[model samples]
Target: MLINDNQEQIAIATYGLTKIYERNIAVNEVDLQIKQGEVYGLIGPNGAGKTTLIRMLATAEEPTKGEIYLNGDRLLQDDTNPHLKQYLGYLPDDFPLYDDLNVIDYLDYFARLYKLSKPLRKQRLQEVLETVNLENKRNSPIATLSRGMKQRLSLARTIIHQPIILLLDEPVSGLDPIARLEFRQAIKLLQQAGMTILISSHVLSDLAELCTSIGIMELGCLVENSSLDNLYQKFSKQQILISTLGEYDKLEQQLKNCPLIEHWEKLSQKNHYLAHFTGNLEDASELLKQLIKADIPLHNFHCEKENLETIFLNLGHQQTS
Candidate 1:
């Protein structure tokens, strides 16, 4: 983690970032500040400039106009700063791997590219292998590894240099559920180890579960940027699901009398009811108490916060509106 004299821990910062290619403005003016050790999720539809923004941050491409600062040091336009290279790691959506090399050899190749010394390179290789849960397959040939294993190997290669910040683009694109879970766990471990990560994923549920904060981009513009909680509050409506024992009619009647509920509906001809509720948790609890006092015979009740997918769609609608 890096901190300046003001005691602010910022891992990456960009101001008025923009990218232009002939007639296309791939990325408009964007300002972002990511704190140290925060797992930030970048969400948006296809061709939303998510990849362009990531590429600029990774130093893989130059921004048309903007200032980029990593750990408080201004990045050069040429992006040839050797010192900055050690602080940033980038894993693109399609990671190229050497099928001929064994797992250890492949990782060793990248470590050498990073100019790590012999002892430190060997230690980092071991650490990264363990971090990605590939220690047992260190001797296995890359060609024989599964897709999930290959993805993990790519991540190991990215982190072998132990960079402080990582930029990942759709890392779990083609993985199965189990593979996605395993990869997510690996990312969480990296976050715990104090690496700030900016990851873009189409998997909204996964992002909701893993990211502490999120930024939503739309058509080369950043429309939303905030913590996950704040995003939910801004874009989600609070709802509650209630299931009654056998008294559906009674439950519906009692809930209709409650002032906290803005609207209520019986779901799909089922006995379960969902209500759009307005109020804090205490108010919700009081409503539950009222239902119990009225003998509504509740079997189950739970509050539902909007998921990432729902919030994303709402943002999309807002964009067009």
Candidate 2:
């Protein structure tokens, strides 16, 4: 498991943040807090307000109610604050591009817009190209780049100004597996450089591999929020997989009286059973000893934990039901 410091500085925070559209609450009241240097994943099904929440964070859409803060400064009250623009970067799922411009020129244009000095812009352009692994394609026309390449290019543009916070909405929507992995690597690099990121994606596997923490949204409400470890601990079952060399009927008869075993299921045709063992490591060891004393031939014993998908589904079901 990856360990992170809870004492890290707050990067983005929203309190009672809400959005309404024509009497519809697109985004109900949401209270989100993300720490600096952490990669936070926002996950939900279609029309779950994931994009709307991100838009509010990016300041692209104003909230009907509530407050938002970035680096301890109020964001809702400041439209002319150049510092907000300089410190926050927002990338939507479909990023519009200047087809006439090549990769290098595209990055250079944004750098200039940020008022970066000419010499510094040149340096930053090279750095971002390298960061996104687009250095070799710097001279390629934006229209000629592949889909994955274009996505990387868009990310390069987002980070070229060295934004302290990034709000990415489905950044890896249509990429192949390898391309998604590459994108994950680029985001890790940025995290190492101390950029706090809030990313939304339906690709739970990618989010599982990348995010330090996750927030599950359902029906425009934040249903679950916790670190990956905490979520796992909450949903994980203390089950044991035991393989025995004896007949299943005999094993069942011998073990029916075991109070510590809550339930059991046969795994395939193999001489294996998954038992819900409600016990710690020491208790499990004792149970194994008891089984041995009872003349049961035990070949293997190990604990199992529920995976991310299961936890995600459970949370969604709990909210909807």
- Candidate 1 lDDT over 67-123, as tens digits, reads 888988887756468788789889999879999999999999999999999999989
Q: Candidate 1: lDDT over CA atoms? A: 0.90
Worst 10 residues of 2 by lDDT: 1-10
* Each candidate structure's count of clashing pairs: 0, 0
Q: Which candidate leads the pack in TM-score?
A: 1
**TM-score against native, each model:** 0.90, 0.84
- For each candidate in the order shown, give its overall lDDT on alpha carbons: 0.90, 0.85
RMSD of each: 2.4, 4.2
Residues 1-321, candidate 2: write the lDDT tens digits.
112265666888888999999888989999988888889999888999999999988888889999988887778546667677678889999879998999999999899888899888989999999889998999999999888889999999998888989989999998999889888889989988888999999888888888889998887899888887887788766888888898667678755777888888888968988888777888788878877887888888787765677678877787768
lDDT (0-100) at residue 126 of candidate 2? 92
Off by over 4 Å in 1: 1-6, 77-80, 233-236, 253-257, 293-297
